[model samples]
Target: MNGTISLFSAEASGPGLADLAGVLCGPGRMAGFGRTAARLSAVVDEPWRAHALARECRRRGAEAQVSAAECGRPLVRTPFRVDLLSLERRWCRGEGKVLPEGFRLDGGMLRLWALAAGSPQGNNYLLALDPEAPETYERLIAALAQLGVPAKVQRGEEALLRVTGRRRLLRVLELIGDAPLGAEAAWPSPVPVVRAV
Candidate 1:
């Protein structure tokens, strides 16, 4: 239930789920987007939650599969693959919409960027945002500053945002909410190791 969010429930339709979906679609560690299909795979710690997620996926007309995790790993893998071409055709015919909320657009994009390539070291977190849209990246930087999360953008093939301190990284995480398991595991522990002599 930690990283899982309800996407199809009427009461669960909100910015949080939208943002989480964006992250899943953007740079999903266990997910992939292709020209024809969009696939999502996540390892949840609970079996029921994994089945629930699969049910949601089935309700949305996607192929869903759930498998128990291997020994020593207490997690279940749930994978969903949906045909994007059909979805796009339906969208073009005004059947569905996948627009980010105006107020949370920045936060959503930031979350996607972080999930795609955010690296948290001892006291710093470095994130790379897609440079394909420079304007969007600028807006994200401005929005982050407004929220008091100091980030410096470095221009290159793929623009990089550097969050210099641990406090700022934590604030970023707070704003973005849940991240992928791999990304979460990549974050260095705040408590330094003290080995006994």
Candidate 2:
């Protein structure tokens, strides 16, 4: 589901974003957070129970934050904003089962756009971290592709490349759907892409 979270943020917008945010940050929606581990044992597979997930996130270093939105979608509150409800859904049972946190890519470029090839919104996310380990990023992108996400991997600043000047890559990504990062899993990943020039 981590793949979905990554993909969702990458492709999120419109009503989908709102419905997800409402379930996450809404008052009384996270009531499950205050329960004992045993009480939540059954719903352990369901992370949308914002309260419980919030507690877990806090434990994992996700601080409490509020997002403002004109409509219903929750806005990003941090450099790495996420809708608890949407994230919860990704972590749920069935096809939605997301990889555990350890399976996710932590450092690299994480970008969120209003539309894949449209204007950027003020709410987009752009982050740069030391590149992830090759295997990790490979697993991450491969996981995304398996889940129907479009991804591209490049060398050095390539991963940092944006849609501003490049038309072909974006078109290809959109055309093929999502793809895995380029580079063999056996190699070391490149540096983190903090900005594109």
Candidate 3:
């Protein structure tokens, strides 16, 4: 079974996103979904991976087409180019699935995951989760805490989990390393802002 992860991008940057995409659509290969446009797609022969791909795509404001080929083969493709700029606004308000079993959120992995799905807006960084999986969100909250990054999980239509404060945001970004394309300028620096007494 050949498995691959695909990511659609206008430019070749965002290694963090690419890494997360690799894990999301991996145990296979990573390549362009098609020649129609600038799209990143993973080719996986297994049904389970395809399902995971579809779920992850939905969570990231994209669509995953399984076996969209001439002969109805098992070739998964996410055609809608993921717009990272507005991803948080889109997915936060939508429905999503739980993290697949055995998916670890260690420092490196978490960094990549954040880069792929996180949104750095205003003074905080938001990570949206599917309200369907409260348990998963709880675990995520705990894990972030373990990493010394305090986060708050707000239950609502968007079900947002925000990492506030410049210190925490900088720590999260430090873990994430380099930001994705179009995101470099937006990455919050490690400089701390002084508050008025």
Query: Best by TM-score, which number?
Result: 3
Encode model 2's per-residue lDDT on 47-159: one tens digit a residue: 22223323323433444343433554333232233334435443333422333353332111121111111122122221111132233344445533443443444456423
Highest lDDT among the candidates is held by which one? 3
Comparison by TM-score, 1 against 2, better one: 1
Task: Give the whole-model CA lDDT for all candidates, comma-separated.
Answer: 0.46, 0.27, 0.48
Lowest summed lDDT window (length 10), candidate 3 = 1-10
Ranking by TM-score: 3, 1, 2
Better of 2 and 3 by TM-score: 3
lDDT of 3 by residue, 23-113 (tens): 3211222232232233444444344445554555555555566664454545555553534322222222233324444433444445434
Question: For residues 1-197, what per-residue lDDT tens digits would candidate 1 score against the true structure?
Answer: 23543232222342332333433322222333444443454444345444544544544455457675554322322243444443333222232233223333344545544544555654666665543334445555665677667777876665667677656665565555564444454342343323334
The candidates, ranked best first by lDDT, are: 3, 1, 2
In model 2, which regions exceed 4 Å deviation?
A: 1-14, 18-32, 35-75, 78-86, 89-136, 143-168, 172-197
lDDT of 3: 0.48
| lDDT over C-alpha atoms for residue 181 of model 1 | 47
Stretches of candidate 1 off by over 4 Å are: 1-17, 20-112, 177-180, 188-197
- For all the candidates, what are their Cα RMSDs to the real structure? 9.8, 15.2, 14.2
Model 3, position 78: C-alpha lDDT score: 54
TM-score of each: 0.45, 0.25, 0.46
